[model samples]
Target: MQDIENKSAPTLDQILSLEKQVWTALVEGNAQADRALLTPDFLGVYPSGFANRDDHVGQFADAPTMKEYELSDIRLRVLSADVVLLSYRADYLRPDTETWEAMLISSLWERRHDVWINSFSQDTPLDQV
Candidate 1:
């Protein structure tokens, strides 16, 4: 049974690769790339509050907000044939800062016109201790 489940499970490599593109956009401050990866009505929930696709892209207006990042503990769930939920822990450094911060993120990716686009995301900051 376990072997059957394993064999039937969907591969996550493609989703992980797509998620990496988003992180790369943040590190490179590429607003166009970021916008391209997200849906026009994308919604983001963060510690700072709610944000839309434009708000997410606006962070790159001046410069890159992230300097570097590492993602781990990745997991993916298929919500439907065209939708998936990707969750992971991210340790990242902000631009001009040496301190690293950690957060858990869940992003929903939906296939639109045969292309995967991020539709929703929620970020939870790790407790500082």
Candidate 2:
């Protein structure tokens, strides 16, 4: 990963675009697309604990669906030339629920072989007021 440090980093717009693509894949339960965006050793930390790449993909097995979602207050921190940390708030409605749930999401992306893929992620649910 350090080898790419000398390479030009991706613009914030490009990173956000990839983030949106990831959200779209999850919302649509598109395992293939999700897999493509995640590294083989990717780990996801959710309220339920840690999930590996397969576990994350298997989450959609029952089609845990979302009716709609919006991302807000997105910001990016460049950890290194080859790594980036993306933080954002996600508000979404479940297909079976009328209320919207919010979560703070942080994802770590690494540039490998000139392509960026998500290496890690964590989701913290926000308490409702």
Candidate 3:
């Protein structure tokens, strides 16, 4: 028998490309792109509290916390045929405190029909240097 996890692992190139689109849409604050990718029932809970798809889509507009989006060092793991997990780093410029910040982020991805959508995510701001 074969190993279940590695049976259909996503190639690094494919993961990079798809994950790049997600990050690009994030930095751009493109709600249209998010709407296309995020499931309507999506829920995201930051270290602070809970946010629905609307809140996640409007991260900059509704909250004064995040001011910028920067992504790096993304790693992907195949959880199953329909689910994938990613861990990475992000930079958030917190306007409230006039601070530049870094964070470790993990996101849950779900493949629907022919597309991958971010169903959930959480982030922890890394300590400043």
Q: Which candidate number maximizes TM-score?
A: 2
lDDT by residue for model 3 (18-116), tens: 656666666665666766777888888787798888877776464333456677887888888768888889876754565667889887887775567
lDDT of 2 by residue, 23-81 (tens): 88778978888889999999999999999999887867887566689999999998887
Q: What's the TM-score of every candidate structure?
A: 0.91, 0.92, 0.72
**Candidate 1 runs further than 4 Å off:** 1-10
Best-to-worst order by lDDT is 1, 2, 3
Which prediction has the highest lDDT against the true structure?
1
Instruction: Give all candidates' CA lDDT scores.
Output: 0.91, 0.88, 0.72
Worst 10 residues of 1 by lDDT: 1-10
Model 1 Cα lDDT, one tens digit per residue, 27-118? 99999999999999999999999999999999999999899999999999998767899999999999888999999999999888778899
Q: Which stretches of candidate 2 lie over 4 Å from their true place?
A: 1-5
A best-first ranking of the candidates according to their TM-score comes to 2, 1, 3
User: lDDT score of model 2?
Assistant: 0.88
Clashing pairs in 1: none
**What's model 2's TM-score?**
0.92
On lDDT, the stronger of 2 and 3 is 2
The Cα RMSD in angstroms, rounded to one decimal, for candidate 1 relative to the true structure is 5.3
lDDT assessment of candidate 1 = 0.91
Q: How many backbone clashes does candidate 1 have?
A: 0
